[model samples]
Target: MGRKNAGIKTVCENRKARHDYFIHETYEAGIALQGTEVKSLRAGRANLKDSYASIQNGEIFVENLHISPYDQGNIFNHDPLRRRKLLMHKAEIVKLFAKTREKGFTLVPLKIYFKQGRAKMEIALASGKHNYDKRQDLHEKAAKREIERALKDRQRY
Candidate 1:
């Protein structure tokens, strides 16, 4: 049997978020999008790279999320790089705000997807990874790949 999220469809992912940060927690957030923005997202014209979330005045907003303008929107097309609000509970916002105030802790969007026709974003509470830490992770990944290859070869022979 295969595990499938029947109604969820991924739109975009920030692949570098994992390599650059140590993720501590993840939150599913609803994006407050305009009509053109939602249409653009449905067309798969969104980018999560270089985007991060910030808490301001008791509200959470995402910056640098680029959702291209809808082709047919013409006069009413929304700005591609405008900050978008994230919908989450007030208690959760307070928690995230506190955590982000700590040294090196930040909110990074991991991926954006649609669930049952509504756009959603998966954001993470993360801390930055140092150069050495990144190098160590790469080395470990290489080692695991080599070990897997050796095991497969052994079984084949």
Candidate 2:
């Protein structure tokens, strides 16, 4: 099947990232992973909830990401929480760095998925959301649910 339609064996997800941050932009970047790490990720044992990205020297790297070791791998197995490098074009990296340097902007990984047999990360440039904003979002969601229910009931009559 196509990459978009491929069966999702999700490696990790950052659920709270969207609730706590207002995402401004998103970019897809390839991840540098060892063979064992890739195997472990394919088994859906990765964690992205506590992960974040950082720039050092001139390269970008993902930190705090946990990729559980393959239970069957030998001494060559990879570390679960090792800092992995993200591969993006020079221009893209520069743009990301500039935007994330702003007061509240941060580099957050939203999800990890495999495409064309390669691992990829969906990263977002986001700003922290205030308590009031979160409350307002919840209220809007409730309102939308009410409207949808009313429409469905009317259609059934």
Candidate 3:
């Protein structure tokens, strides 16, 4: 299941992350955004799909994340898909790097939102899901939905 992001202004989300991977843990990290990039994100022009975090030289960076160029920025607009740095603690980065080194573990961005007027991203430590596992998840969700509908109908009588 996806993380619950209540009481926050969500800019964009990777809706398929939960379906494609089994999330183990999540972290809230500040994004290092350029002036135009921040404006673009505030205007709701961002995509988290296919974005992933990688630790390089003991620092974390998010790759493939697209924040569209601000409409009025023109010549000063930042690159839409530049590698953005993520602000996280030293010890946490080391821990995450070690975990990602393990087989089948990776970092996936779940969502991006503004918290107390600052841009924050929710990144997850996840493992990929096999075809059979995906099928099972679908079936379980269907069953839960049917049960809820049946109970609602019963109460209406």
Give the number of the best model, judged by lDDT.
Answer: 1
For model 1, residues 4-109, the per-residue Cα lDDT tens digits are 8978999999999999999999999999999889889999999998999999999999999999999999999999999999999999999999999999999999
Cα lDDT of model 2 by residue, 65-139, tens digit: 999889999898988999999999999999888887889999999999987688999999999999999999999
TM-score of each: 0.96, 0.92, 0.95
How do the residues 15-98 of candidate 3 rate in per-residue lDDT, one tens digit apiece?
899999999999999999999988988899999989999999999999999999999998999989999999999999999999
Q: How far is candidate 3 from the true structure (C-alpha RMSD, Å)?
A: 3.5
Q: TM-score for candidate 2, please give it.
A: 0.92
List runs of model 3 lying over 4 Å from the truth. Answer: 1-7
Considering lDDT, which of the candidate structures 1 and 2 is the better prediction for this target?
A: 1
- All candidates: CA RMSD (Å): 1.4, 1.9, 3.5
Separately for all candidates shown, the number of backbone clashes (residues 3 or more apart, or on different chains) is 0, 0, 0
Local distance difference test, each candidate = 0.96, 0.90, 0.95
Q: Model 1: residues >4 Å from true position, as ranges?
A: 1-4
Q: Indicate the TM-score of model 3.
A: 0.95
